[model samples]
Target: MLETGQVISAENGQAQVHFKRTSACERCGACGMLANGQDMIVTLENTIEARPGDQVVVQMQTQGMLQASAIAYVIPLLLLIAGAVLGKLALAPLFAGVESDVVAAISGIALCALGFLGIHLLEPRLRRQKRFQLQMVSVHRAAQGREEEQIDKE
Candidate 1:
């Protein structure tokens, strides 16, 4: 996804850009850090030396987003199915056809919960990887009063 935002602050070769919420972002809860439904601040390297009040274009890799979606949604589903099958197999002999299915269902739910917990704990590290981050690739306007778009070679 691509977005246009103004740099709110700049320091240490990085900038925090403030972006207004758009219809394209409505379904994407990826920016969960948004304080409200209307705005978001993203910190990224200021490759174009953009300053506060500068307009910039941010690019987020669509492939990485899809991979993240799979990790967040599909893995737990697979775990649930595996847990159900394993639980049923293990309890079948013990229960001998008595409430084993119920026990398996509970085990599947518990296993899926664990999967979610694991993903939550690893999120910070996953987010630190560059492939999953948004990159500011162009400057629409510099704080120095230029109105030209500056495109950088990626």
Candidate 2:
């Protein structure tokens, strides 16, 4: 996805850009939707020589985005289903006296929680990888002017 953001700060080959959340951002939910209407600020490598106050278009890798979405959404769901099946089949047989349904519920919940914890633990390592990073495509001078004009009109 491509987004327009204003450079908030720049130094030593890096820049911090602030993006206001829009309706499109709601669909992605990359930044948590807390209902606070706050801006999403990200620090990116400054290959384009964008300065503070400059408006630029940022691009995130499409493949990486899809991979991330799968990792965040699909994997946990698959894990939950696997957990439920395991509880019903494997774990139920081991806990002889207990009700099979109850054992299944408990085991499934435990495994689902473990899946979430695993994702949390893996996040930091994912962030350090360059393949998943967002990039600044170009400074959008014309778009910036249009934005300022709209603000003035409002």
Candidate 3:
């Protein structure tokens, strides 16, 4: 996906870009959220030599986005279901006086929590992979008021 933003800082071949949360971003909070909920900051490889304060466009590989979404959404859900089923079938019998439903609920929640922890621990490694990285594509000049007026005139 392509995103447009202004470079907040750049160094060591990487840049932090400031972007307004767009429609796509609202639908996908994989990048997380900042305070006020309308702004986002992304750090990416400065492939085009983007400097701080420069307007630029960046692109993220589609495969990376899909993998992230699945890891974030699907794994936890599957774990919850699996845990519940296992707890109801095996664990509940092992716990005297515990209802199968209660055991299932607890097991499902605990397993989902573990899944989140696993994802957190795995974050640094996944982030280092190039497939998940974003690359700055090009820097663009900020439009001037006179330019807008001229374009409108035409």
Note the Cα lDDT for every prediction shown.
0.82, 0.78, 0.82
lDDT of 2 by residue, 9-102 (tens): 9899999888888776666655543346657878889888777887878888889888878878888888888888899999999999999888
Q: lDDT winner among the candidates?
A: 1
TM-score of 2: 0.80
In angstroms, give how far residue 38 of model 1 lies from its true place. Answer: 3.0
Q: Against the true structure, whose TM-score is highest?
A: 3
State every prediction's TM-score relative to the real structure.
Answer: 0.79, 0.80, 0.86
List, residue by residue over 1-104, the lDDT tens digit for candidate 3: 98888888999988888999988878676565679899988877777777776788777799998998899899999999999998999899999898889999
- Residue pairs with colliding backbones in model 1 are none
**Per-residue CA lDDT of candidate 1, range 1-154, in tens?**
7899999899999899988989877666666447676988778888788888778898889998888888888999998988888779886567665687887897788899999999999999999988788888887666355556666637
* Number of clashing pairs per prediction, in order: 0, 0, 0
Candidate 1 lands at a TM-score of 0.79
Question: Between candidates 1 and 2, which one is better according to lDDT?
Answer: 1
